[model samples]
Target: MQEFKEREKQEQTISSPLSESLYENLRRIRTVFQTSHDVVIRELRIGEDKNIPIVIVYTDGLASSQSVSGFILDALLVHTPKVEGVHNPEKLFELMSTSILAGGEVKPLSDFEKLYLAVLAGETVVLLDGCAKALMVSTRGWKDRGVQEPTVQTVIRGPREAFSESLRTNTALVRRRVKDENLHCEQQAIGRITKTDIAVMYIEGIANEKIVKELFERLERIDTDGILESGYIEEFIQDSYLTPFPLTYNTERPDVVAGGLLEGRVAILVDGTPFALLVPVLFGQFFQSAEDYYQRSMIATAIRLLRYVCFFIALLAPSLYIAATTFHQEMLPTQLLISLASQREGIPFPAFVEALIMELTFEILREAGIRMPRPMGQAISIVGALVVGQAAVEAGFVSAAMVIVVSITAISTFVFPSYEMAIPIRVLRFLMMLLAASFGLFGITMGLLGMVLHLCSLRSFGAPYMAPFSPIRLAGQKDMIFRLPHWSLRKRPAMISKENPVRDATPAPAPPRPEGEQS
Candidate 1:
């Protein structure tokens, strides 16, 4: 009950007007921010006869000190402008807003809560002696990383730009790509204490309105004290909690977000995080890359097929190795079986144990490589791969066949376009290995069946996770498993966009006849 009261207090909307008396309003605001040392309250005497009293409230680190000092402080302090209407405080604030302050954005805030929130969020708020409303000036500034190449979603042929931590900059990156006027970005502030800004972006006509409404509703339901990153929003809004697979796809690439927006998908961009979340995510989209659209369809399609092939191999290879060598030796060829039997003769552990050792060792090394310093990480990954694999094989810690299988699985996991997709596969690989150890090929088959069933059952914001494959929407299948030529991809995924189906109505292209030939 105490927690509920606290939440109610935090979630209270700022609809009431500010206190009429300047002393009372200032006292109330200061009482709330009494513990905060970084907040600055500068009193100024502006307007004609220099009797008009005003106070500037802003947080120290969040706002640009230089802008406030140079533009606001200097303008009112030294170069004071005469007020035509001295008696009316409301008109004085209006006049000062228009002609007195010449720099940055200025918005009128009627509610004291809104004013204080804006002040805390880095905007300079100006309160006049008699006026009930305050002016919020744009002064947001903080040290942040500039636009850099996406470390995870890097592509060879596509644009190299990635999203930055700044919300406006990230949104601008998407806006620059999607020039359509119909593209809309709706903004909201979540987290009671942090008040993190989040934007829900989508194409007005193309994206499904029902999904957009649902997405916003879920966001509104998040009643946390703070949201540090996009991951928080993802966890709160994702459809299924039971599954490891991410229903929403997140990426640091702007071009990727723009492409999704064009395809009738909604994107959620969170402040302070480069990663942006895309809704109504599909399984096949995980295998696809940004580079696919940049290169020839044939090459892209071939690569897409390879990723899918690797997905299965990465998922089932080690399990199959354990099953075939342990339970079903007859499944292997005579010479291969003999070679495996010979290799296992000196080994102390069983086939499952052997494979488990190798996979865990590799995973540990891979993790170490990522967590360590970049230079050291690269060196460790290279040295560890060579030293560990060869040493394990030489020391008879694992069989040569098992090493090959584990290595192949690792390589296949790396082939996946998104790391988010690879993670679930990596986790499920162990379960499959356990199942195979118990029931061999039968166990493997059961594991696959369970995985497929879960996938079919999963829904990403009302859209089927395995769409164009499970429910078998024919229009959505054109770009699945294989990347049909752009011209051949006549319609968008029927599940995603029902109205904006056909993207290209033109027939396939053919070479023009010889110059002499006529129609």
Candidate 2:
């Protein structure tokens, strides 16, 4: 069985050069695409006697009809002179490629493998009679959702444009922002069946050479049949998969990607996904937002600190409440303790079970909201949560205080700048609650310590996941937990840009002083 599977893989990868006979090539291609109704093949004559046969092939919907008709067909049928020399195979091939084909991108293909790949990728292929090589012209114009405002990483004071599914468009968006000679976007294909295009973008000098090489090697090692999203690549290439914390950060905003590139982090963009993956991400990076750079340093710092606070609230709010009410009631003020006791007077379940029920209900509502139709999803989730919580409280199944704690925790989860970062927090929240339920505050403290130890041990493409904090790098602290002024962030993250850390060379800007003022 293994041998048969190996043979199948070998046959799939085998490549054969095209024959000089036009009908022979057509027969093979037709056989391969016999069941595919959208495969288009048009035969035409282009000589004085109209005896020379040529064929143009492309996918019907994937290739642009306008480009095929105007650029390729018109150039061949009307522009090319119907002369005697056109009958000669070599002469005809040279003339068509050098002059007749009006398409800006035209390349010669000698193998059936490359020809099939090109045609499938929405490029028009021209095969001339008695010519072994075929010309692949760029005519890709499939339908796509154009750049829209970021839905996931929306910013109040930054560029509103987000990446689309098209890989070329996504690269173009990043290029428009980071128009530097040092910026490089190299393309490669992954997945045997899907042949999904992957673009690795980074600034040449600023990016660490070791990290870039390691990333490329890891991508090359991926031997999957299909890669439909950036998440697939993230999973395959990430340094550690055992932890709940995300090793790679994904964002839909091009500005965010461009900023990561400028900071010496490599961006992995999958062809069909709007979210691009940025590698070597640190724990602190998730708390930082694109808007942080747009706002004044003081305001940005405050908001960033708030996000950190929210992170803890999301991860520990329910757990702390359970621990305090169940085992540490003495720690609370007398008035607060009495109020909590009153709220839980008729509650049938323990603190842990009560919190668990409320948290699970909220998760259900949140998932329902996302899966339902967008127009009504938000409404259903909001209204359903309110009604359910009110009914539960009235029936004495859960206290109003429990509902408030769960609500605040849910809100805090949304505070993370990167949605991927919030996922682990949500998962860990349940575990933390369980710990609190079992051993009160001691369990919660142990869980926190374990999470910190796990985070410190984790790595993202060889860079410490808890960088500048675990290792205590003073250089990276400028942008961690606080939004320092742009001028203050003169160097890139040491682990990411080890080759060349100096990112900014300009002197700090200063306003002009009054003429009467003296130094």
Candidate 3:
């Protein structure tokens, strides 16, 4: 922490305009970049006499070598000698910017802060002998993971391309999908030291102005040393920090971001991370997937409803089993009760302790599977669970029924389309189990009510977290738990696109009228 403050102070002290003297400028540059072996400073002489002094400063391996050799160096050394009136430093700088370095994107930079930003961002900076301003040319060419298939959010029918680590590449992917003049991408530098680039994207007229303004205000208020991923920005800008539920949605797919922008939601794309963040997320949004739109409406609706059912099963399965066996034994059938009693005759722990043991074991296996190598992960999780559960059942540690309940709950948790939403469910399941252990069915009911009330009270960028359910918007319901036919979804969700509510106007399809029937 103290090092960060010292670095900040050093940067502040050097934030001044560049000098016209070439030697003095070189001294200051060397002072700032002392001991940085990768900082390449190439001195060159331009013009007919070959005495016009200039220095090229860039970081090796960041700025493309081919571009520097072919376009910049060749232009200054070979092409400028034939031109006339090149002795004056101001005229030389103008000629080089306008006619010499014609192949590259060049910008005039005056202050040291701007110069350092351009150079560190993989661009070449040229300082003339007697000119106050320097030329910054874009030549970034670092190794990157080219566009690859989605890993976490895999979809069978949607586009196979996903966002890459490069900010420009990610933006271009979205641009390719949403080709509209109103698709606005505003860029800003976040992180005091990292200077990580972030783009705030939304449609101009379709997005709510208030939401956009608020988002900008929140981003501007963030003060940090470094932003490693979109998650950092999400944490800094989220409405509440106490809740486990994620207020912002993140995805690696560009189609998801493009879809969000069309719905008037803002997207934040951070550099050095593939995941992009969508703001003002709702509870229902996590249940819907990109495949929901690709498939037929009825099938999508059925799948979406199944996800909601799975959500409850994942949340309440263990708690219900604990409650039934410990407090409400009469709820079970007589025959089943006898079998369960026979199985638990020799067990030492009570129902709650038994369930907690199995739950913790399963959770440990799940995390191990994720952290281990891919080939061993699946094998370890599957084989370990089967062996441990069987041994425990045979040794009178837990009943077979408990193993079945835990397995079902684990499977249901994997059914969620958004993993962020599933995480909160996993956490709440433990709380629900505790409630059921203490108060049985009544405690479970009270927990449900409290969870629903909390969801209703939560807000994502001032939009209701449980929108269209707590607020009960009829228009938004068409695409909530049940995705209606495409033609029926003619308007965007409330508060998202109030500026331009209507999205689609096409009516439902019908067979063409046969042979001129009389009206």
Predicted structure with the largest lDDT when compared to the true one: 3
User: What's the TM-score of every candidate structure?
Assistant: 0.94, 0.96, 0.97
Q: Give the TM-score of candidate 2.
A: 0.96
Name model 3 segments beyond 4 Å from true. 1-9, 81-84, 516-519
Candidate 1 TM-score versus the reference: 0.94
Candidate 1 to native Cα RMSD, angstroms: 2.5
Scored by lDDT, model 1 comes in at 0.88
Ranked candidates (lDDT, high to low)? 3, 2, 1
Instruction: Give residue 295's lDDT in candidate 1 (0 to 100).
Output: 92
Candidate 2: tens digits of C-alpha lDDT, residues 1-519: 999997676456437788899999888788778899899989998766777788999999899999999999888888778667545788878888888898969889999888888989999999987989999999999999999898888888999899999999999999998998999989998998899999999999888898999999999999999999998998999897798888899999998898898888999999999999998899999999999999999999999999999999999999999999989999999999999999999899999999999999999999999999997999999999999999999999999999999999999999888888888899999999999999999999999999999999999988888889989998888899887888889888887777778778878999999899998
Error of 3 at 286 (Å): 0.7
Least lDDT summed over 10 consecutive residues: which range in candidate 1? 7-16
Say which prediction, candidate 1 or candidate 2, comes out ahead on lDDT: 2
